[model samples]
Each structure stands twice: as structure tokens, then as C-alpha cells.
Target: MPGRRTTTVEFVRGSVRGGRRRARSWLPSMFTLANMMCGFFAILVAFRGEYRLACALIALSVVFDIADGAVARLVGAVSPFGLQFDSLADLVSFGLAPSLLVFALFSDGRDSLDALGWIACFLWVACAAIRLARFNTTIDPTADKRYFTGLPSPGAAGVVLASVFAFADLMEGRDRLWMLLVVLVPGLLMVSNVRYRSFRSLVSPKSGKPYGLVVTVVVVLVGLATVPTVTCCVVAYSYLVSPLVVPVLTPLGRLVPDRLKEVLS
Candidate 1:
């Protein structure tokens, strides 16, 4: 009887542990689902002509996207399923949502997008899909994980969001024709050979105190609080052109403080 009771207790403990593991695994997926829902709602809102709200929803989706990956890594729940799910969620949020938002902007109250507008918006979706697909198929363990081969979808979407927010009146008027470049430039960059820094290390340094990171975050928050439109435009446009600017600025890197360099590198 004692032996049977001990075996039963061990089995119960194993089951309990297994149940907890399963629950933890679901946590990341919950965030991914939230991301997808945000994209879906963004699309709906865009159709209703709520440009700012749609852009905000897409931004919220980016937060959920980051959270899902961070949570999955924290729980050691990374899996093939999670990877595929993340890409799909990214397609909806960063690809389709932004494309629809731009299309809505160009079309306004018209029946449909013009030929150039259609092409520009479609290019964004196509390049975003290609970027995600290439990323999944070309995962290389030996390659530099700190840099992406092409512009990230979220970054491309950021360009669109920033343009809309910064040039709200321009995008609404006859001058909106030039806004096509906003979508076209970022869309093309998403498939270009230019490498973009991931900045993951800067945001979450593996070693040393995160004082630089904290300061950067505080500064960004202050900018957002004080001059949100300009701040977003500066950040988005700077990242868009960083591949070109970083090379030119590389020589000046020596002037940067060591602590700041550590956080940036």
C-alpha cells in the first residue's frame, strides 16, 4: 500500500508540472492572437475612415508582437508553431493593416484606389510578405543575428504611420500625390539588400547595467509627450535612411562614450 501511494503521488506531481508547462506555452499565443485582433480591427477602422485610430491599432499590434516573442523566450516555449504563428500575425498587422491604411488614405471617400495608388499599396503587402517568408526560410545560425538582411515590416509600417501623423493635412489634400513615395520607398526597402540593425541588444543588453537603455527610453518618452508627431517622424525617417547614414557616421563612432557604445553595439 505504501509503494502504491508513493507512485500515485509522483504521477500527480508530474501531471501538475506538465499542466503548468502547457499553460505557460499558451501565454505567447495569447499575445499573438491579440496582435492579430488589433490588425483586424485596424482594417475595419480604416474602412470606416478612422485613419488615426487605425494607425494606433497597428502600433498596438507591434507592442503585442514584441511581447509574444519576449514571453515565448522567457518561458522557453519557442517552437515551430510559435514561429509560424508569429509570421502570420506579422503579415496581418504589419503588412495588411498598413497597406489598407495607406490605400484608405489615398482613396479617401472615392470608390477605389487609383492605378498608382493601387500599385503602391500592393507593393507594400507583397514586399512585407516576401520579407517575412525570406526571413523564415533563410534562418542561418551562423549569420549575424544583430542585423536583418532587409527592412523589418514593423519599421516599414512605422514610416507609413509617421507620414500620416506628421503630414495629416498634406495627406488629406491635393498634395497627397507625393505621399505615394512614403509607401513606395519603405516597401521597396523591405525587399532590398540593405541591412538594418535589429537594436535588440540596445533595448535588452545581455551584460552590464541598462542605464543607457533607460535614459534612451526616458528621452523617447519625453519626446513623444511633448511633440509626438515630430518625434515619430524623426524616429521613423531616421531608421528608414539609417542604412545609408550609418556607414557615413561609422567613422565618428569613436567620439561616442564607451557606455553608450556598449548599449548601442
Candidate 2:
């Protein structure tokens, strides 16, 4: 220790990192940044033909996204600025970015949907803006977590990304009409009023009995890692169908408990 020497560069680097830690205490900001970063990388990944990785990053961003709000509350750092930043990042990550990735991957530059398809991308951004705006305006004292008034925009983006990846190789030589159906359907779904499960609620409610849930989540993570492409397709498709399943079967209706009604109402 007596012979130890200190350098200005190391001290400066430490100071900068310390500053970042304090700044990152605002949790939602960190999550929002991650979402933007994911979208940024997604564009590059698609261009590089590493589509599976791109989709995975987008999915990972969704997880980070769900955490941002919760983290904001936990850290007592809720702010209008963070909220706006989240919306902007989401529009990039889940709205415009996914849309561009789809066209880039699946389209002929000369098709009619070339014009129409680009416009459809805006539906995602517009609907997401509306959804977030509605959420901010409609706050209730009740702790209700059941259904979404409409399909969540980010979930819709996930389905779109999943579809592209699921049938990545299979898409070649598929009927043009079929591709059209795939592109348009998910765009419509983003703006539809269908109930979707919100895992965000479980965070607080299950905070008490954390161990069992933690183990279960760990297992699920293992399953996801084992087969990324196939697993995402299955999960996203299952979610896309749940809205239809929810309406047709009373049993499906039962899946969304009464508390969820507050949300839809």
C-alpha cells in the first residue's frame, strides 16, 4: 500500500461513474433509455440480418418497459418528464421501429401497401400515444388489474415482431395476400379493445410471497432461452388469440377476474 500511486484518469473515471449512479436513481429514466437503446439496436440488427436477435432485444425492452413505471414508484421518482420520455421511447421502440422492421423484412418496395403499410405504422404510434394519454388521465383509487380497454400497443408490436420471426424462413414463396393479412391484422389489433393480462399488478400483490413466484419465473426464463424463436411465436400467438377466446368462452371470461372490470369500464 505504501508504494501505491493514484492517477488523475482513474479518479476522473470514478467520479463520472459515481455521477451516473446518482442520475440513474431515477429508475424509469433508465428503463426508458433501455427501450430506446433496444429500438436503436433493432434497426441495426435487422439490417445485419440478425433478425432473431433483434426481436429478442425488442422483447427484452418490453420487460424493461414494464419495470420503468414500477421502478419509478419504488424510487419515488415519478415525474412528468420521465413519463413523456417513456412515450417517446415507446413510439420508437414499439411503434415506428417494429413497423419499419416489418416492411424492411417482408415487403416488395413496389406494392400498394408500400404506401398503405407505412401509414399503418402510424396507427401504432398514434394508438400508443392515445393509450398512454388515457392512462394518465384515467386514474382511480381502486387497485384494479384485470383487462385492458384495448390491446396494449407494445403487446401488438410483440406479435408483429414474433410473426415476422416465426415465419422468417417460411415467409418466402408464401402468398402475397397472406403477407398482407399478417401486416394489417396486427396493426388493427394494436388499436382494438380486447382484454390482455397485465403482469404489472402481480408485482405488488405477490411481493409478500416472493420465493415461489421467483422460482417459477426463473423456470420460465429457462424455457424462453432454450428456444427463442419458437417460444416467442407461441407466446405471442397465444396472447393474440386470448382476446377471441375471452369473448367466445365464459371460461375464458373467468380468466379475467372481476377486478379487471374497473379497467375496461
Candidate 3:
């Protein structure tokens, strides 16, 4: 009887631990689902002509995308399922949603784009898909963690969001041709070999004090609060051109103090 009771207790404990693990695994998926929902609604709103709100939804999806990865890493729940799910969610949020936004913004009341515009928008989706696939298939444990092989989908979509917020009127009227550049340039960069710095370290630093990070975040928040449109525009476009600019600035990097570089890196 005593032996049977001890076995039963151990089994019960194992079951309880398994249940907790299962629950934790699902938490990251919850955030991914939220990200997908935001993209879905962004599409719906974009069609309804709520351009700003649609952009806002896409921005929110970016937040959820970041959160899901961070949460998955935090809980040790990173899995193949999560990786595939994240790419799918990214397709909806960063690829299709932004492409549709471009189409909607440039379309006349006919709910369609000219051939050039249509191709430009479609290019964004195609390149984003290719970028994600390349990332998955080329994963290397020994590869440098600090750089992504190409422009990330989120960064590509950010260019669209920033353009809409900063220059909606100009894009809608006299400078409408510029919108094609906005979509096309980033879309092409998505498939290029140009490396973009990954923010993983900034988001989840493995070492050192977080005070510099705190101050940086506070400054960014203040900029967003004070001049959101300009701030977003500058940040997004700067990143878009960073591949070109970074090479030129590489030599200058040594002039910066090590501590500041650590925080910014």
C-alpha cells in the first residue's frame, strides 16, 4: 500500500508539471494570434478608407510580433510550431497588410490600381514572403546574431506606415508617384543581401546595466509624444537607408564611447 501511494504521488506531480508546461507554451501563440487579428482588422479598415486607423493596427501588430518572440524566449517555449506561426502572422501583418495599404492608398475610386502601381504593391508581398522563407531555410546556429540577412518584413512595412503618417497628403496628390518608390525600394531591399542590424540585443540584452536603455526608451517616447509623424518618418527612412549609410559610417563608429555603443547596439 505504501509503495502504491508513493507512485501515485509522483505521477500526480509529473502531470501537474506537464500541465504548467503546456500552458506556458500556449502563451506565445496567444500573442501571435493577436498579431494576426490586428493585421486582419487593418485590412478591413484599409478597405473602409480608414487609412490612419489601419496603419495604427499594423503598428500594433508589430508590437505583438515583438512581444510574442520575447515572451517565447522568456518562457523557453520557442518551438518549430511557434517559428512557423510567427512567419505566417508576419505574412499577414507585414507583407499582405502593408501591400494592401499601398494599393488602397494609390487606387482611384475604382478599387483597383494601375498596372505599375499594382506591380509595385505585389512586389512588396512577394519579396516579404521570399525574405521570410530564406530566413527559415538558412538558419545557422553559427551565424552572427547581430545582423539579419535582409530587410525584415516589419521594417519594410514600417516604411509604408511612416510614409502614410508623414506625407499622406503629398502621396495622395502631387507626389503620388513617390508612393511607388516607398513600396518598391523597401520591397527590393527585403530580398537583397544587404544586412540590417537585428534589435534582439537591444530588446533583450544579455549583459550590463539597463540604465542607458531606459534613458534611450524614455527619449524615444518623448519624441513620439512630441513629434510623432516626423519621428516615425525619420526613424523608418534612416533605417531604410542604413545599409548604404552604415558602411560610410563604419570608420566613425570607433569615435563613439563603448558604453553608448553597447546601449545602442
Give candidates' CA RMSD values in order: 2.0, 7.8, 2.2
Candidate 3, lDDT over the whole model: 0.88
lDDT (10s digit) by residue, model 2, range 71-108 = 88777677878878887888778876676677666554
Candidate 1, overall lDDT? 0.86
* Ranking of models by TM-score: 1, 3, 2
Can you list the residue pairs that collide in candidate 1?
Answer: none
Off by over 4 Å in 2: 1-25, 108-113, 141-143, 173-179, 202-204, 210-219, 246-265
Q: Which ten residues in a row have the lowest lDDT in candidate 3?
A: 108-117
Summed backbone clashes in each candidate are 0, 1, 0
Task: Please give the TM-score that candidate 1 achieves against the real structure.
Answer: 0.93
Error of 2 at 14 (Å): 23
TM-score of 2: 0.73
Q: Tens digits of per-residue lDDT for model 1 on 1-265?
A: 9999999999999999999999999999999999999999999998887888888898889879878988998999998999899999999999999988888778774643477788888899999999999999999999987899889998888899888867755655556677788899999999999999885644557756666678878988899999988888888899999989999999998898897777654
Rank order by lDDT, top first?
3, 1, 2
- Scored against the true structure, residue 250 in model 3 reaches a CA lDDT of 96
| Clash pairs, model 2 backbone | 146-260
Superior by TM-score: candidate 1 or candidate 2: 1
